[model samples]
Target: MNNRLFLKEVDQRISQADLHKVDNAVFVLHDQLNMQVWPEWVREEKPPLVFIEAKAKGDSLPYHKKKITYVLSSMRHFAVECQQEGYPVYYYSTDQHYDDGLSDILESHPDLVLTFMTPSEWDSRERLREVKSSFGDRVKEIPNQFFFADPDAWKDNIEPGYRMEYFYRDMRKKTGYLMNGDEPEGGEWNYDEDNRESLPKGYDVPEITGVEPDDITNEVIQMVEEYHPNNFGVLDDFRYAVTREQALQLLDEFIEERLADFGPYEDAMATDEPTLFHTNLSIYLNNGLLLPWEICERAIQAYENDKAPINSVEGLVRQILGWREFVRIYYEAMMPEVRDTNFLDFDGALPELFWSGNTKMHCLQQSLKPVIEQGYSHHIQRLMVLSNFSNLTKTDPRELNKWFWLAYVDAYEWVVLPNVLGMSTFADGGILASKPYVSSGNYINKMSNYCTSCEYSVTKKTGEGACPFNYLYWNFVDEQREAFEVSGRNSFMVNMYDKKSDEDKKAIKESTNQFLNQLDRYSG
Candidate 1:
């Protein structure tokens, strides 16, 4: 009853003969659209492909308009590509839940057997399992192959007190990437120390290419607007690649133009440029349009060909082969409870500035600009600026995590939850990160030119017209003095805060309290 649109259907009512004639159907989830991951039987037998656009799933969050558009458009494109390759395609646009939508298909074709790869999301996997219960052996679930990390291997090999660096080393050894026999190629496992240079003035970043919306993407844009009018983010310049071919082209461009300088400027922020020398492949990587191992290989190839340096190549590899894989493993290990764990117990609300981008603070405004328009910004902005400010303000980690899930195009429960709760918010208390990733105006000033044009004085540490980050950071350190001392890793922060003069300490409290009160007035 909730079948909203059947965009591409070979037959409205599949015959029993049609169902029995094929070996089985492959129920391709939105994120599992890549051909490389398909079972060998699928390529030989050319099984019917099933795709469902479940409205209930989209409605679960106030997702950014562009995020929904990207997923739906990419799914639609993949379904058509499968059809061109002689696979029978059944694409359903429905207002029902994924399981419920599949139920209709099951009822229509009683002889149909559905094969699905295990979903990246925990909830989606569970829902598919529920469908399996009703139909018994009709639904077969296979392991996901889009990622380099194996979940079963992670459980067996990963020791307690899990750390990404160790896991990353093991992965490098296993893959033999950036390795000189048994040792690392550069005699070092990490080059993150060299990756913090800020962008010099008037630096010209290479222009990123965007795919023009074809008829398929244009139709998807209209459909998203019709259904999700209230969603966040603008769709004015919709430019994401909807097909694997387009994604590959973008990857090639990054390797040629950006990968060489990517390491030094990876943490840099420019007022005029949102993405500087960084590969925006996560958009494709998250949704199966791109594979993880292939992306790393391409970057390594650049290094081998002398097109890129080891710092840049290893840095990029660490992101995909190291951090990304580790986070997915962490998410799987600490789910259902990690979503709500507030280790710091800070319950302040996320400010309206995040939604409106109406703050006079230039860093917040500039950092939020790309996110508001494109549902994206680089990792540095997401961590050092957005998350730093949230931690300083004492915003509930859960609220900030939810906002991130709503805002980013590359977000999903598996990745977003761990990064937000574990890494960004420190909500899980040293589970995924050793310490809280908090910084003051000084770090921002060093990394970006946002401070140069900010309304507040970045130098002034207290009183009116002073940057709020300066006082809020000190106040957080003073307030959490006991916690830092207990942790022992960042106790120097407390020692430094203790050395401040009594008058200076008093002024910091006054400034922070005054700003928080004014913030509450407007927020309420």
Candidate 2:
């Protein structure tokens, strides 16, 4: 929070070619098949252009120092692709020049600078608004054709006070994914009962496709190494889907090997298992390299061709059309005000192990290692493990929020912020999630085998071998007694808290604070 240090950090990022790629595909949105006249928005604005490339406040953690370079690198590559096809392109980097990016766009005086709409940090949306408004008729925010939902689709009716189940069901009917006319294929809207099945004890994951980017990414990797030298993951291990070809190849791999079991073990976790049945597709999907529709279409093609099952295909589709789209829409409908809403009102520091990965708890240690080693963890790991722990500890939403934003590779503020503050932390009332995803170590045991060799007992709440999570869970309940007392969803927790002896209650408080006293060091 030191202003001098903060400004100094900002100054550093500004010099690093931050705006290396900023220009967008300047296009006239035309209806090719209809052969009709272009819309007034298109007509009024001569040839419209948007600044497509983005940059973050890389003044934070260096988990993916390569992340910044990847963006600039891929953008520069994308710019080349556009230019080859005779599309005028402009690009910028926040590293080399910061606000100059906006100024450069203004000098062009393009009809409308379009971008896939997103919110950065606290001031980003407002700053973008000022830039757009300052330009008067120039800045037009558009829906990312990258995602499944219509841009304004969820704006008018953001289904509040509901979890994803109902949303998933509605999306099934609307999209006709896994549907035959009006009825769902397999006579099921969701395969929840079937999907939760785990891989047999020593399950082996098939080979995954890794894309070593072309020279552009290689150059960016070199740049990140030269500048932001010290980071969590090894740069040599960096193999993100940087270009369109790599993304498509990865899509084919998962569809061929992992897609069938992906649905069943989507939420499963394990100590030794890194890429169990999960398709490491998020990195590609988050970046513009792979579009969600193409992914879904390919998976759906597999099902129709009898290569993959309806269950597998439908589950993957629901993620894109249902969960992914829902999150983006819900995020747009309820941001700014929503980010600050901490309904439970719990306040405490996060545990030290989050950054250090120094914990005796085996589950955390195993899960957290990948986050450090790769700058990526799937949604289940983010939500149910690291984030769930943060919520239960009642860590300051901002504190936990900052870590999530700083660490992950795919964590652009637009995507990460909503997932972090809204879904993971549940700071925004119940807008993104119905309840705080608080859990004891036992839940971790149920999901993964990380509990098997842990020093602490998942089965015990107190005594010499008592799990720290047991203590934390009880303390979290007691800490938020006033708010949670009325929560019917948390009634069972309250009842359990009431059943605890004073000695055990005192012990839980002591252990929980000991854990909370050291928050900054822990990422999980």
Candidate 3:
């Protein structure tokens, strides 16, 4: 009877265009099935219901209560969607407090209890596993079908040395998404080099349409206003695709409108550009509502229909087959301890302004501005900007993991964990990535306009006018030198540090502390 999860997802971030389409879609499903009430989809009389939440751990700013509101709202929405389409949904908030909900669910006496596989935090899956052992067949946890890859896919491939390039190449061969028989469509497995073009000066993005809410969404807005009055993210631009029908429209928009430029710029960043050449589709992709096969089919159909170029089609498919699939598989292949792997052994808490966007660092401010306005950021902003800063500053993996999960509109643990802890922070020891994506102000400067407007100096390594990222980056490297040595990619860094004077190194340490102590200043 509690179907709020599904409904809230629809209510938040659903475009006005898609709202009409979703309404029509729900009507079609209603007419086609000649039925209503989601629980009816439990054709087996009992479906071993699953309760889901894409939430942050909330060890830092904005606190955990705000997270509960977002996930609880979304889960409630999903529940409503299921009830409308004929399925049983039993959900709890995606928070530190799922135990009581789990206990309540246990009392429901389901044939099985289920949860999505996660690589970010161990407690979620571990708790579910314990629940399963006690309940046996009555608690079967399944890999979330939201992702495109099989859960075991990453585990299945073990070459002489495990690497993403090899896996990506293999995927290209198997799926033929951008393949010309045995040849890759772009003559390469990746177009990352071609994708790094920065947003040109004064280049304006077109005025885009936003998703408006339906009755269910309006109800969620009411709930947001009443039940959880202090959620951190903005509620104004809430337009997430929560239902199967609406999710399709999002898929279609990406295919017809943005897919053409998606591949080359998937990694690029722009200060004024949020969507840019990228599709803000991860929200739909992470949720169970959006099926990967259908998305792939649409991209493939676009190419076959001659509507989009091969570069475009290949780029779209690569994310599904390469990055997205790889993340899920990579997450399952290594976990439990992976969540605990803090390469830098970073123990500091997350900053206060991550929630408030009150920082002086221009990159942090602008990157966060959109997050405040729309509750989203492209992958690079998540990985390079936010995650990169956390890594450089040596923020605790646990804290960063929570921030990644809670702060973004698109974040769900299954997708965010490996990307945050493993890939972004190197907290998982290279199971998800071969090396930590640690970088300094220089890299951000090259890719974004954030550094251009910031108070910090991108070129300075320490002291006055120094970019916080610069000092923090060096400090993190020096502290974690032993750990990075194990990665085998730290030779250049080691050499660089070895050549530096002890005085310079001492200065770097002081500068990092200076930043950390004044976290409130930078955070705001």
Q: Of the candidates numbered 2 and 3, which has the greater lDDT value?
A: 2
lDDT of 1 by residue, 454-518 (tens): 99999999998999999999999998765466468799998999999999999999999998887
User: Number of the top candidate by lDDT?
Assistant: 1
Point out the higher-scoring one by lDDT: 1 or 3.
1
Query: Candidate 2: where are CA atoms >4 Å away?
Result: 1-57, 60-63, 92-99, 108-128, 137-143, 230-234, 481-489, 517-524
- Taking all chains together, each candidate's TM-score versus the true structure is 0.96, 0.82, 0.77
Q: Once model 2 is optimally superposed onto the true structure by TM-score, how far is the C-alpha of residue 365 displaced, in angstroms?
A: 1.6
Candidate 1 residue 437 C-alpha distance from true site, Å: 0.6
Residue 81's lDDT within candidate 1 is 80
Compared with the true structure, all predictions reach lDDT values of 0.86, 0.64, 0.62
Could you give me the TM-score of model 2 versus the true structure?
0.82
Question: What lDDT tens digits, residue by residue, belong to model 2 across residues 263-363?
Answer: 88887887767667777777657766776667878888898988887777778887777877777767677766766667777566666777668888787
Better of 2 and 3 by TM-score: 2
